[model samples]
Target: MPSLTLADLDQRPELAPAVLALFAAAPPGAHHLVCGLPAAMGQEPTAEILARTSGMLLALSGRQVAGAIGICPYSEDQVTLWGPATAQAAVAEFLFTSTREALHLSRFGSMRALIDTRNREQRAFYRAHGFAAWKDNHLYECVLETRTSTGTVSRGSLAFKVRAATTRDHNAVISILTRAFPDSDHCLPSLAKREADGYRHYVLEEAGTVVAAAAVQDAGRRGWLKLIAVKPELRGRQLSRRLLEGVLASESRRGKRTMALEVLADNAPAIALYEHAGFRRKWTATIMTGPV
Candidate 1:
């Protein structure tokens, strides 16, 4: 085997293309995994998204980029690992160990990696490194069709409207998201920053009050449904379906060709709702976490 060398991508900016190719050339059961970002099959990470990472560690073997890893800080206490993307299995551990050493991993409380369920080798590798399988997440997507109209729906004398949220709706949307995902870093104080990053929030309003909400991250022809929630008091009312319909309608109007999202494998209600809406599970991943 050739001797491997590691370099910080920022310092060796010229190696960017090879690092990207390492990710693009990923094969089944060894795909490059990025967290806190939307990446569908055939989708390549954009420069803007790469720029969000705190570090990119590249492994080289005689001028060839053999492996790479991108570190994205998710919060003060957690960071998401993008990859130990390597040309051969022999380099996976070297890439991961070098990354931990290069980035001084101890500052974070934990690290996470989301790997395709089929990647049994990678799963076992992480386990050997002290990571535990947290849960399975299913990635679902549906082709979208243009719609001419959408309006309030009525069910048993109750009517609700679904539409893109306005500035005035920010508080309500954030409140619902905060309540729904209390531990999430995507809500509250970060909402404005996220909106600036092209996330759009939609709401289902009943009598002028936002009853259900969803946040979408638009990527040209596709939208990633990041989070969706209904006000707790109205869960039995099927408001989630209504809000989802509205979101689809809105996305269609914006020229989106598809919508994708990830849901917990155990979330039966959410799975059924997406399935009923024509979304099909494309893949499953195990979210593994380990102390840093």
Candidate 2:
């Protein structure tokens, strides 16, 4: 390996091209907006943008960028990263840890990562570098053209009234999520945030009480399922599947070509339900936290 040097992106904006070249080789969904594309000789991302954004540092083999690491915001007080995948573990560790310290994450909060679950190499790198797998998220996409609508889908015995979540259902929805995903760092979107983010939610009411809820957001030509939860005590009613079907119907009717959602890979019941509903596995995301 060639001798490598690290530099703050804020100072050496000229290296953006080399860093982006490294990023382009990683799997899809590695970075966004900036896409970390190699900058034209005189066309680097402005210093103002780099300064206001999360801390980012680049790893260079001499003058050519080899690897880079930086924070990408995920939620309030939480962040993630966008960097090269082929770099050595030592280089990754130094850039990531240094960026974390530079941001004073301990005072603000640890930056988080939504890593691809199937990429075992990435997972191992995260583990070796002190990142804990906070959540195991599996991505699934529903092909709208081939699925049954809510009107045609039938349910037996486990009957529940499915309807759009109302403002009054906010408290009940939050309670269900707290019980369903205890201690998990998943992005439990608040009802206010939901509306602000253009998310629509549906709730499953068993005898007029909210037992399960799920939300999906408008993602241009595609639909993005944001959150779903069922009460802890009610386990085998298949309520989640039911609500998902209902949401899918609405999503399809709105002319969405497809819908996507993420669930914990270990949650076999949810996995089975999604699979049965024709939501095939698209990818798996491993939620990783900042270096310790």
Candidate 3:
């Protein structure tokens, strides 16, 4: 008889393969398991770095992994869930029960998931589980596919050159981030663990001074674009378009079919730029909070 079970990923390292399979089976543009699993599948999950070292679990039908759930701390009282994928009712219920218990154990007051709106089944599942839309997250993809004749490269009215970043450029990248996003809402592994981080990093410099930067990390078959920021004073020069093109072109050449990133609901200008570049809306991930 196949009995439902729940276990931490560390307990069943072999389940990584099955877990990756579940992610691949989702909608074309669905965000794969963002934690535990490799940025790209077929590779091993980063055991030491997933889920902020808190609540992470795998659902099982006897010995076979059926699904998984992860809780990344968003604040002292809040957590961000990664999965609860396209799973069966009983499977999801078990995962949710395990998740809630894990949260209570960890003392977190609220929990939320950034769900993809395009995946109707998953969206319906979240709603059924009492998750609500506290806000909207726009996920866009395909940097190269969206290229227009208008030229994706930034001519750099200020005379800037784009190139791969090195350790020496780290502080500059941080400086630009501080100035451009004083209340930073986005987080990247590079910022958290650059030493072991695998994401390819790039930077745009004007007269030898780093002014803009972007990053791309492999997510199994696709690539995820991280933070792309420009100095406030240089925003009008289309530096963003150039930096994105430079990053996307590099990744596309590597044979990655698509690239993706997320922006908050109110960031219309950034969404417009991505749309102009040929990137389409893959889905909207809702960050549901409180009891659900």
Model 1, span 27-132: residue lDDT tens: 4345535344444333566565566688888878888888888887777788878778775766888888876675574677788888888877778888998999
At residue 46, what lDDT does model 2 achieve? 41
Which model, 2 or 3, shows the larger TM-score?
3
Q: Please give me the total number of clashing residue pairs in predicted model 2.
A: 4
TM-scores of all candidate predictions against the true structure: 0.91, 0.69, 0.72
Highest TM-score: which candidate?
A: 1
When 1 and 3 are scored with lDDT, the better candidate is: 1
Tell me the deviation in Å of residue 165 in model 1.
1.4
Clash tally for model 3: 6
Task: Kindly list the per-residue Cα lDDT of model 2 for residues 3-42, writing each as its tens digit.
Answer: 7777877788776665555654564443321212111001
Clashing residue pairs, backbone N/CA/C < 3 A, model 3: 39-219, 39-220, 40-220, 41-220, 146-277, 146-278
Error of 3 at 276 (Å): 2.5
Residue 99, candidate 1: alpha-carbon lDDT: 66
Which 10-residue window in model 2 sums to the lowest lDDT? 33-42
Between 1 and 3, whose TM-score is larger?
1
